[model samples]
Target chain A: MADVPSMEALEALLRRLPGIGPRSAQRICYDLLVRKRNLLPQLATALERAHAAVRFCERCNNLSEAPLCAVCKGLHRDHSLLCIVESPADLRAIEDTGMFSGDYFVLMGHLSPLDGVGPEALHLDRLSERLAEADLQEVIFATNPTLEGEATAQFLADLVPAGITISRIAHGVPVGGELEYVDRGTLGRALHGRRLLDE
Target chain B: MADVPSMEALEALLRRLPGIGPRSAQRICYDLLVRKRNLLPQLATALERAHAAVRFCERCNNLSEAPLCAVCKGLHRDHSLLCIVESPADLRAIEDTGMFSGDYFVLMGHLSPLDGVGPEALHLDRLSERLAEADLQEVIFATNPTLEGEATAQFLADLVPAGITISRIAHGVPVGGELEYVDRGTLGRALHGRRLLDE
Candidate 1:
């Protein structure tokens, strides 16, 4: 195996991918080399194409081929409402729901000082510029409910101008999730955030 | 997301890899595009390099940059003994033990009629040729103990010349495994194939 440098290099690179372990990396290496040989060129071409073409949206920081992402350019979406999320995947998750027809601001990542991710790293200036320029009446913090996400949301929330309303997405037990199976933190949050039912 | 065809293409290609699902594919896409942008070119280069340089050992069907794999070219290994395995990963696993100083033949895959894999796909012809050419005294079937693997080993065992001793690797409780936790089938096999202890 040591004699096969190319295969080793390929396995090492695959191992660097998120969630892929050593065994999985080797499996992928073998899969590319043997079972899915045809996928090699296609994957390589896709990587090249992505590197050559994909760029962050100038307005929202979401991945886009053009200066503005599809959501940013769409006329049907509400310009007065904005949703700030940690990543493009989150933005897409929100978009998939068909709820929130508002514009978006992708932070790309949350505040993690230990990992060296700070406000500057998150493009806070760009977010501020968008907030100042856009006639946004409300901004929704759709970051995950984790500590870092909450801290990031709080940091961004404080940055919003005086007039605009700011709110965080609720933290509660997920719909269709069993109460008994829910974690303690979530159950606590769900109970604390409970609303009064109107007859 | 659809507007970014390159990203979409990259995600689609990543999704096709074994064990990667839709969400995982998107996560990997984001990881490559955002977090690990530098890895893109390196991964692409690795894929290109592997595709261009990696070739199977003409003798053993193991992946190799050269015509013959290191094991096949080694001067110290017992050329009289050959171990048959299902994949390169299995071959490496056996090699990792620092035991079995023998040559090898990689079957690449087991017979799976449901998926259309058969004898020809496993390259039994090359195995036959190697068997005929090499002065092998014993052939060990190190194929997985699964149904298809057993069938493949049995099929290949039938092809070995009359004089060469044929054997399948033992299947029972693993070396460090507790007997209580072992599955019924494996325990049954262990009981059925129990060996007599010599004083």
Candidate 2:
């Protein structure tokens, strides 16, 4: 099997992907080479096209084919309201909800000092520039409710001017989640953040 | 995100791979485009190179970079003893054991009537031709122990000429397996195939 250089090379590349172990890489390689032969060229072409075209949006840092992403370029979105998230995947999740019609700034990652990630790595300079330049009225922190995310949010909040309103997305039990199954940390947050309801 | 044609195309192509769902595809796409941007061209080149170089072995139907696979071209292996397997993965598994220095004929897939695979799909014509042309003394069925694998082995056994020894790999409790945990069917087979030990 090692004699097949091309196969081994492809398998090694596949192993580099997130969540792909050696066995899984081998299975995927076999499936592509044998079961779905047509996909080989299609995937290759797709990779090349994406490599050439896809880039970070100049305004929001989301994935874009051009300088500005759809949200950044769109006329209808509320530019005054900005939601900061960790990644494009998080932005996509917020977009899929259809509840928010505002601009987004993707951090690309959180502030993790242990793993060597910091404000510079997250492009906080660009974020601060946008905050200073844009006439934003409110900025919502939609980062994950983790220690690093909270630290990043607090760090970004300090950089914003005093006039703008700053807020964090609520931490509570998920809509369809069971209270019995909820962890103590989430339960505590839900209890602490409980809001009064109108009769 | 919809405006990013290349990104969507790459994600769609990735989704076609085995075990990749929509969310996983998006995650992988982002990981490639943003996190490991260097992997994009590398993976594309690997795919193109593998597609151009890899093809079925003319003799054994295994994946090969040339007309004949390494095993088929090797002089040290026993050509008179042929081991039949379902796919290149199975052949690789056997090869990893450092045992069975014999020639192999890869069926590529087992007979699946529901899925439209038959003797023709398994390339029985080539198998029969090899059986007739080669002065083989023994043939080992190394196919999986599943129902389809067993049927395929039995079907191929009938094609072998008389006086040629035919054998199936033993099914029994695995080396580290406990009797309490062994499945009933395997336990039954193990009992039935029990051999006499010399005192």
Cα-based TM-score, every candidate: 0.93, 0.92
- The parts of candidate 2 lying over 4 Å away from their true place are A133-135, A179-181, A197-199, B133-135, B175-184, B196-199
Q: In model 2 chain B, where is the ten-residue run with the lowest total lDDT? A: B128-137
lDDT of 2 by residue, A24-81 (tens): 8998988888788888988999999999999999988899998999989888998888
Candidate 1 backbone overlaps, count: 0
Error of 2 at B53 (Å): 0.6
lDDT of each: 0.90, 0.90
DockQ of each: 0.84, 0.76
Clashing pairs in 2: none
Q: What lDDT, from 0 to 1, does candidate 2 have? A: 0.90
Second chain alone, TM-score for each candidate: 0.91, 0.91
Instruction: Tell me the tens digit of each residue's lDDT in model 2 across B1-199.
Output: 7789999998888888888888888889989988899999999999999889999899998888989998888889987888999998898889889999988999999998989998899988899987875669999999999999999999999999998999999999999899999999999999998888962
